[model samples]
Target chain A: MKHQRWLPWVFLAPTALGMGLFTLIPIVASIVLAFFQWDIITPPKFVGFANFATVATDSTVQVSFLNTIVFVIVAVALQLGISLGLAVLLTEKLPNWLRSFFRSAFFFPLVLSAASVSVFMKYLFNEKFGVVNWLLSLINVPAVPWLTSPAGSAVVIILVYVWQNFGFSFLLFLGGLASIPTETYEAASLDGATGWRKLVQITLPLLSPTTLVASVMAIISALQVFDQPYVLTGGGPGDSTRSAVMVIFETAFQRLEFGQGAALGVILTIIIMLITALQFRLSKRFVFYQ
Target chain B: MTTTLEPRRTASPRTRPAARRRRIDWGMTGRITVLVITAVFVIGPVLWTLSTSLRLPSEAFSLPPSFLPLHPDFTSYAQVFQQLNMALLVLNSALVTGIVALGQMGTAALAGYAFAQLEFKGKKALFSVILATMMVPLQVTIVPVFLLIRGMGLSDTLLALILPALPTAFGTFLMRQYFLGLPPDLAEAAAIDGATPWRTFRSVYAPLAMPGLAIVGILAFNYHWNEFFRPLILTISEQNFTLPLGLVSLQGNMGTGSISVVLAGVILSMIPAFIVFIFGQRTLRTGLTSGLGK
Candidate 1:
């Protein structure tokens, strides 16, 4: 083949240029924007950490970050736990149709938009007349303040989030479980390992790498949660459900405080990077790649 | 840990008895039943939304909430159209999503093929940079992205939504994986026929990569179709709003719109996605599961 050195670059130009302009340059500009106070209407003025200081001390910003961390921990846990449990159960030798049926059922929610899911969920969790409280009454539990109270709203946000998200992790775990050789399970069975014993001693260890990936992805997305909180509680019953991205969205777009929004965005991005890096570092100690 | 995990020396390698495996274990049945119940919890809400949307507003809150839309009504659907520019929103969503998907498929394939087949300086570094973009959340870059859009004079336009999203790191990676899976002989055969690399790629390799491109296209369509955050930031006018944005504003109008009508809007937004799910599930599953395999 002739050495057409420029052919590759011709192919690479679009993605390379597009990512450079849209993603890479914007990232650099955002970091720079964090230090300057500017509304879109005016020239950006150098503020040298003033934006950061205000964002760090702002109570709403502080609480929103706190709410985000809490959401990540709880949502990622529930997402991984539910998905792993169902994936393991589905691993049992079932009819082919049954297996596909279970896979489809578990992964269905991944297809819906988060905004629409939150919309319907708001009605379902309504305090006065909703199915959730109605079902609770069947078991003699009294009506719960689902959307009206802070604790109730937080719980509803997490539930709605996990309901929509667990499918993704479930799909990953299923793939992980499928790749584990059947002979390993057979050997465990022959060694007189009970179901619980095999799950603890074999399955979980083998699935750790997948667990790491799922949790990393889950936590990153969870930390940036906006749609659910925005739609369901409107970040309300007070600032109980407000999130880091919501702060960014409102600060910049609603308030025209680009500097403050960029500052919050910078802080959020740093946390995401640090958490991701920490997960990789932690993975070195725990993930069992097979 | 090793002591408990040690295999018993006397253990036979042969499979367990067939009849024992064939026996209908109550525990297994219990597990499946538990999964079934969980599925209902996961899917029941969406079903209720669909059901409620099919009924009159007065019937939406009826006790023992109807899971089925028996005696279905089209009035709420009609009401959704009457209140919102249903045609305009759908067209906007379709245009943005369609263009973004096609653009991503093209760009990802080109970059992906370069990495998979063509040797270049800094290839590894370039690929890593592209993949690393995944870690940068849209929120982080959105403010600057907005400024850039304004700089381009594209603010509040559908082009604002469509253009920035054309470069997809994950799609490039996926297409790379797909290209690597294709047999190397196809390219070699083209070369033996004295075909240039450009001619070979156009006539030989690209056609073989159709299924791979479909995976990228479908995944892109699914993502951009339901995307809210970008459109929320980029598109301000009602005329330019996508389906998800339109639905959120519809929720904001709940003081006027009945619950059924609101849910009717929700159901309408889900139709294209649901249709894609039914037809493109395999490609989507393949793209998703293997997309994260790294």
Candidate 2:
């Protein structure tokens, strides 16, 4: 095509404008907003480091931070373990129809909206007449308070979050497994390596890159969890399930503390960036990319 | 080592087929057992949701918790529509998702085409800037974005939700990768035939990029359709509520008393996503793997 210098600019204009106005400007604005006190109606006044000071000593922030850490560790660990296990099973030599069936079934939850899943799980874990308690009652077991109690509610949130999200990692692992050349497995088998030995020697080592990606993604999503706990527990009976994002949302929208909320957002972004950067740095020794 | 060697020692090449068949049978049996267990874990709750949605309120909350409702009732679905005003929320969600999907595809394609084919000053720098923004999660920028939307007087409106989401760095990157893989000779031939850059893009390149368009479209649709955080932050009134917000509020309002109705609403909200997934299964699979695998 006849190269026109203006044409590329024309094509790029809408995206640039959109990103500039919404993404780029807001990013800078968020940093600035973290230092200002503003309600929607009133003009923003710069408050310097006051918001950060409050965040440092706030008890709610402390609880939320601890809860978020617990959630990130437990949720990411379980999700990676289960999804990798599922991916390994699905990738085994199986009938074509069965493979597709398992893939679709496992991935089906990813298509459901988080809100829908949350609602479904909320009712499923309801204290009185929930299916879970009812099922427990079938075996002469007493009904457990799934959502009312703090520890139980936290576990429910973790399980539901894992249920809704693990499929993404499963699919990623499946893709990684599919990409491993069969010749490597065949060669290993010829060397009298089979079953668990072959898997530990060849599969785990080769799948390290995929594992790293999936783990990073799992951690990121786990740390950002909001929808499930927001809907299911609303930070619960005692703030046991309150995630950092939940606190941020409630602070900004519910309480109209935009400055503090922005401060929290900034803090969260820095924490996530550091964690992600640390993962990438540490991955250099473990993640093989051949 | 002994464990690995034992299986191999059991059969030589002459007897391998028979022994392998026996092992295969055992493996299949074990595999089926594991598959059933996993399938139950994955699909059981989903089936429970459907059953609860269809059951009478009394049956839905019965102590024993029957898997199948004896007298299935569609009244909860009716209640969701009547009491919750689900139809309007569905309409709002559809409009927002549709606009965002089409807008994202259009912008991504144009930007991707430029990045892939056209040379411009600071192309590399600009592309890198866009790519870097992908790392900034929406939660970080949401506060300022909300303020910006309010400042523009777009709050409580679908525009607030639609405008910010129209341009996506990931979509642009996906399209650029796809376009870069296209044969360059087609565009060259169009150029030799006196086609302008715009004309070449419109006729020669656009048609070839339909797969990329579909991938972006499906992804954008799924995202905006299910998006809760943005709508929750932006929209104020019940009239402007998307399906997720509506369902959530319905859960709160109904409490535990109207569980069937809430389940019905949940099931209703999932129908569109299920339809999209079924129809675009192949495209979505490829899109996810290719987008994230690298």
Candidate 3:
């Protein structure tokens, strides 16, 4: 091929320009806006560290951050735990059609819109007219106020988030499980290892790399969760289910506090980056790559 | 699977009948029980939604709710259409997601080709930067993005949702991986024939990369179709709402509306994504798994 000086640049222009205008520029604007006080109609005024200080001391924002953290931990754990369990089960003996059927069944939720899922899930979890309480009554249990109470909404949020998300980690774990050579398992079997012992000594260590990737991806997405709680609870029972993104949305849009919103966004972005960086740092010791 | 079946299959001749009973072993029984229970748990809610939507609005909360709708009703579906601008919502959502998907495919394919097969400086740094943008959650930049959209005179319109989403990091990475996995000899053969770089890509590589383009396109459609946060912030008018945002309002009206009607709206929203799931399941699966490095 004859050397073409600008062909690559031509190819790169659209993505480069679009990302610059949209992603890169907005990020810079968000940082800058964090230092200014402006409603949608007001002239922008420089506020220095005031916006950050106000946002830091804001009780709702603090609770939302704390809620976001608690959310990330529980949702990620349940997501990884359930997905790993299902992935292991799928690897067991089953008809090919049956296996694929189960796989699709688990993965089906991932394809649905989260807002829609939250909508239906809200109905299902309703205290009086919902199926959940109906079933609970059938079992001689009391109706729970799933959406009204703080702890109940927290449980509902985790359940709904995990239900929609575990399939992703399941797919990752499936991929990881597929790559494990059967010979290693056979050698363990020859040494009289069976069931639980083999899973601990062989399957787990061999699957660590995939687990690392799955957990990291799961945790990152879980931290930014919004659709479930925003729709289902509307951050009800006094900011109980409000997520960090919900706060960002509320302050910037509903309340029209753009500067404080931007500050909260910056703080969240920093925390996300720190958490991600910490995971990678810890991966050095725990993640087993083969 | 072979590991599970090996012992049974290799059982000595007289033990074959015993093998048949092996299916009742505690491990096998427990495994099947868990799988069946899980299958029920995972799929049950959606079924309940469908059944509830089909019941009369008055029967939406019938005791011991039936999975089988004895007398299927259409009143709720009628209510949904009457209440919302169903056609406009679909039109708006289609316009946003369709164009966004196509735009992402174009940008991702070209940039992916450049990163995969073309020679350039700062390529490594550029690609890593693009991938790093994935970590910047949409909430973090959305306020400024709304301002940027406003600045462009596209405020309070569907374009606000479509434009900011045109540049995608994951799609680019997927397409790049697709292009890199392509056989090297296509470009080599075109080069040996004295083709220009443009000619090589246009004639040789582009046609073969359709599947890759499709993966990106489908990924975009599935994502933007269900996207909520951006549309929630950017689009304000009722006519500008996507399916998810529109459906959220349906839920918002729960104080006055029947639960069946709300569930009907929810079920209506799931149809497009469900159709995509059926036809593009394998493509979506490959797109998800292939994004992970070896």
Candidate 4:
């Protein structure tokens, strides 16, 4: 019995140890380190709330925070909408060939790395020879500055985020769509319900649980946007595209202000936690998990 | 719920014939048109990158540029090797990704097996903690992780990247949920046969959970291989740079107009992940959809 008792602990041992060193420790250290000032090489000193105050008042941080908010709002909204639409269409017993083709085409971007995607987009948006510009020229529209201007850069970044992440939401939506009973649709058809009315009454309400999870996840990922902006714009065109995470990164490594970076990270973390927790709490009202 | 009401409302026999026909036309034409437009907007940039990669240096930047590289050159890929030891970077990526995937899978599988199959004190609490960690944005930990790596003097090595990745809370949760579907008698029978826990895990539970493991591995590989920020801060040397970091450096050298080399780097970097996806697409899709708690 004693030996059997040890088995659970033994089975849990590997993950416990791994999380202790890698997950728990780092999380605790990062939180505590936020209260101190250090340059990694120097001894850290208790600086209390100064780092927090400094980050809060910093103009650059404010811009990044705003950019992050905009990116999250726009990108998540667009991605979720497209994904839900695709999910509904694909799951409606469409021709298998078309379903497969659309599925692969939509999901293709999800596999490609952000770095590569940005690199590819860089050429596509190139002012002189880019295909996008070339295509626009055919329509008699002027070439738009894509990565060079602040607003332009944010637009591209948002587009990329939407493109890459929509697949995940689509998959989840597909799953939710699969679970809906055929009898429900059959009964609705008998009653003469159809189109947007049918969709609003049936699909939207049924997909609530998936929508809640996907929306919360989308928000979290949007706030954590790093690679796309980092590679494409580096928060460039005058700090216009800088996200909160970018500021944290630049503060910590580039400036070597470890404490300040940790402080910014902690603030971002708390806000994220609060937002996500609120999402979880609110989801209870609407989400009907099967 | 809404989908149920759609076909009924539109296809109802009570509706006027002309209006019904118009609605049918709109539904079919409108949705397809929008999908096609979205596809073009979504995939245009990526396709351009592929075409650029195949173009000769002269054709790459020619004004009113070539959509398809007439005389396609694989020279840029060769240049990746000659200039950056691209093969070495690929090797480094594979080694690190492989190790991290395996390490994470092992931890996740064991923990997940326990969570699903074994009962113990604090199990609910511990599993909830694992689930809670999933909500913690990874960005919060990067600074501390970097500091940890630097302190350990592992910053310039692959160890830095591989070590931090092994403890994946999400993977554990995924595995646990998957394993929950298996009958308990399988493990109990294995126990009766006198197999050790590790042996039973390797020979019995693992094979049963292969699909879940594949999903875990594929996601892990895509995540680690595509990762840019960690490698950027951790690795200092050119030789140690993974594919993404190497590409960033490659872009720096070629600058803006050298579409040939830049596109080449992008194309080359995408190959491994694309290949994995092609073979693993079904598994990934099924895994992702089904991977969340049933």
Candidate 5:
């Protein structure tokens, strides 16, 4: 029963070592690397602010930046809207088996890797032989160039991203819906609030905490999207679907430009940090904790 | 959870008026219709993938793409295994995922126990640091992490992929939250019985934390299994590739002509996750809700 002073440290040592080596140190190293040029072979040369200057002027970086912003906005909006709708519907009075089945079915895609989904969707959206175009053609519609055109590929990426991710938000929303006490609904009904009015006045305000969490999660994942776009379009169709992470990957690994890549990473980190901070600050009026 | 709501309806049948009951029926019908449509929309692509994976090569791109293959073939599965060397890639992915899962579970449990039970200097500050790391996206640190791995001569090796991910901030946070919710009297009784801290943790807390452990393990497995970017960056040769990387390579080499084979590879890659999901659906759902809902 003696309190061993070092026992806690012993317990913490492994995680501390692993996290420090992998996450903490690397983070600091990334910030430092943004100022230096290195190709993994030569000694890094210090070039303060030069990499940042390049990122500011780089057209591909600009395109990727714009694409990432647009992708996050559209994807988050669609995902939240659809997932919340599904959650509300699924939580209604239905056969137990049907409810469970629908829940599992909707969540099935979350278990699959984004890479697999991307590949399957790439084939699904194939310009010539894809099932999507085929289905469109069945209705006397002309074949659409899904992955071949810039705007088209962008749309595909957003849709694919939403498909792969909405399940997560759906699950969270279900949890939120379940936690709402039945008395609240009864109270709202007594007050003559039902349907759209009930959802907007009572359910939504009470569910704001869940909404806040889901929105934050959706935004973060959407902004960091790499796998779907990478595997599906390879950042192609003239770099339409290229995300910030994809650009960083190509810049560092393909072009062997570590400094610029590090710079881009820093810029991305700052942008995400700022956005998350702003969300938290702005959420004060909307998020209801009780 | 859904079962709890069922009784509310049964209890209301006698008290509810006829008009209310009829309205409820209409609502049920609308809900079922919407649920069916959403289910189809969500699961349609997966079914399509299954169909394409089984279809014969010639029938894969037939003018009217068959909803179901007329003559199903398992040959593409064979092709993926034989021609693309998927077995090795699967084994590699399994190895990495297994190690990372075990590593994360063990480390997270130990750290979580300490943070939840023991009083240590700088514990609060240290825990906050871990939480902060969760907000720092992996993309932000990829350059340095990549260089660090290369410097350690782990590039192109499974170790490169496994080592960096072993200590997960989210996993530790989850385990800690679970431990915090556990009653403290059990640990206190163990201490009064003259059990050492390690024994108390091993014999008492660890067993009770199985649900938390399972959640962490399933999540870690799913993440490392589906991971694409790290393996793509770390490994250069086909021999070191994981499933995602291998599937990409298969697509590149096979092109559109081998669409069936590629779909087979995709289907094969999805099976393990599907199996895990089928068995662990409850645990996965509980884990997700608990982690985020709190």
Candidate 6:
């Protein structure tokens, strides 16, 4: 009995220890660290509500917070809409061989590293002789600074985020669509519904749960946009393209304000948690699981 | 009323057949339109890059761009090997991803076995803790993890990259779910046969749960192979850089755009993932679809 009792722990000990040290401790410490000021060389000093107050009032924080909102709204909304549309189209009674081919092609980018994608995207949008610009110029629209200007760069970032992530949501929606019984569609067809009318009435209502899950994920990911903007624009043309996480990175690493960065981290965490919980709550009304 | 009467009186047989054919043609056209649009949007940039990589600087910048490379060039691929040591980076990424996959699969399988089968105290609590940890983004702990690795003198070492990732909560969670689907009688039979728990896992449970293990392995492999941030922050020396970091380095080091080199680097970073997708397509697709829990 004694030997048997130790076996589970033996299996679990390493994982538990690592998670405790890396995950649990840091999560707790991140919240606690938000209340203190530390610069690595000096010992941390707790200043109860002072850091949070300062973060609330900081102009940089406000800008990033607003930027994050815009990013999440556009990125998440479009990602869900387009992916769901694609998923429906792909789930049609196509030949299995072609289905597999289309699935692989759609999912190709999902497997690539974000850094690689960012690099490629940068070149794709390059102004002077890049592909997108060249294509635009063919229609007489002239060049648009993709990563150089502020507004144009923001649009580019959103476009990249959508392109990279829609595959994931598309796959999820495909799975969900596949699970829907053929009887529902047959019944709809019998009612003389087809095309956009059927899509709006039948498909949209049935795919709500998948949409919720995909949207929540998209929102969380969009809010935490770091790698794309970081590598593609370096959050550049001045902090114009900087995201909320970019601000956190700069605060912690560049300025060495560890405590302030942790504060931003906590704020972001709270915001994400609240938003995600709200999504679940709201999904109760719209997301029909069955 | 007069127009309706005229049509009813003089309905043309040719017009009726043509109208029916047009209806059929419209559906086909709609499907074709959607497919063409998707193909253009998804495959266009990739094809453009491949062509761009094969062109000279003059050819690359030329107006009314040549769709195909007039004179194909392999210089960029050569440069990646000769100048950037991309082959070494590929080896590094492959080694790290492989080790991480093995460790992750082995650990998740064992841990998942304990969670699923063992009637241990704190089982539910421990599993909950793991689930909750999934919500905590890695961005919060990255600095501390870096500091931890640095303190251990493992920074810039492959160990720095591999060890921290061994206990993947998602993988463990996935395995637990997979194990739950297996028949419990196998474990019970093994126990009745005087097999130790370890023996039971190795012989019965592991084989029964091979599909799940493969799924976990693919996910872990893809993640680590494509992992960028940790390697970037942890490894200071260029020699220790993974493929993604090497690609970033190549991007930063380029002068006058160096389009071909960048494309070559992009292609280099893509090969492992592309190969994984090709070889493990079924497992990867099913695993990701299931793991995402839609």
Estimate TM-scores for all models. 0.94, 0.96, 0.95, 0.93, 0.95, 0.93
How far off is each candidate at the interface, as Cα RMSD in Å? 1.5, 1.2, 1.5, 2.0, 1.3, 1.9
Candidate 2 — which pairs collide? none
Q: Residue A206 deviation, candidate 5, in Å?
A: 0.7
Poorly placed runs, candidate 2 (over 4 Å): B1-17
Q: Residue by residue across A28-79, what tens digits does model 3's lDDT show?
A: 9999999999897989999999988975678998899899999998889889
> Each candidate's DockQ score against the native complex?
0.69, 0.78, 0.74, 0.59, 0.75, 0.55
In candidate 1, which residue ranges exceed 4 Å CA deviation? B1-24, B183-185, B191-196
The predictions' CA RMSDs to the true structure, in order, are 4.5, 3.1, 4.0, 4.5, 5.0, 3.8
| Fnat scores for every prediction | 0.69, 0.75, 0.75, 0.62, 0.75, 0.46
Worst lDDT run of 10 residues, candidate 2 chain A, spans: A1-10
User: Distance from true position, residue B103, model 5, in Å?
Assistant: 0.9
Give residue A214's lDDT in candidate 6 (0 to 100): 81
TM-score of 6: 0.93
Q: What is the lDDT of residue B51 in candidate 3?
A: 91
Candidate 6 Cα deviation (angstroms), residue B91: 2.7
Give lDDT tens digits, candidate 1, residues B1-294.
Answer: 766556543343444444455554777788889889998998789888888899888888888877787799989999889888888999999999999999999999988888888778899999999999988898989999998999999999999999999988998998888778877777788888888888887888778899999999998998889888999999889999998899889879765348888899999999998988889998888877776755
The parts of candidate 3 lying over 4 Å away from their true place are: B1-24, B183-185, B191-196, B254-256
Best by TM-score: 2
Compose the digit string of candidate 2's lDDT tens values, residues B1-294: 998889788766679788888998897888778877987888899899999889886577877777888778998998888888888999999999999999999999999999998888999999999998988888889998998888899999989899999998999999999889888888899888988888888898988999999999998888889989999999999999999999999889877887899889888888989998799988877777666746
Residue B252 C-alpha lDDT in model 5: 80
Candidate 3 has a DockQ of 0.74
The residue-level lDDT of candidate 6 at A1 comes to: 20
Docking class of 3: medium
Cα lDDT of model 5 by residue, A1-290, tens digit: 24678989998998999989988998898899899998877889999999898767888899998899999999999999999998998887778898899989988888888998898899999989999999999898899998989888988998988988899999999999988999999988898887889889877988899998899888888889999889888898887778899999999999998988988999998998888888889789888888
* Candidate 4 chain B: worst-modelled 10 consecutive residues by lDDT: B285-294
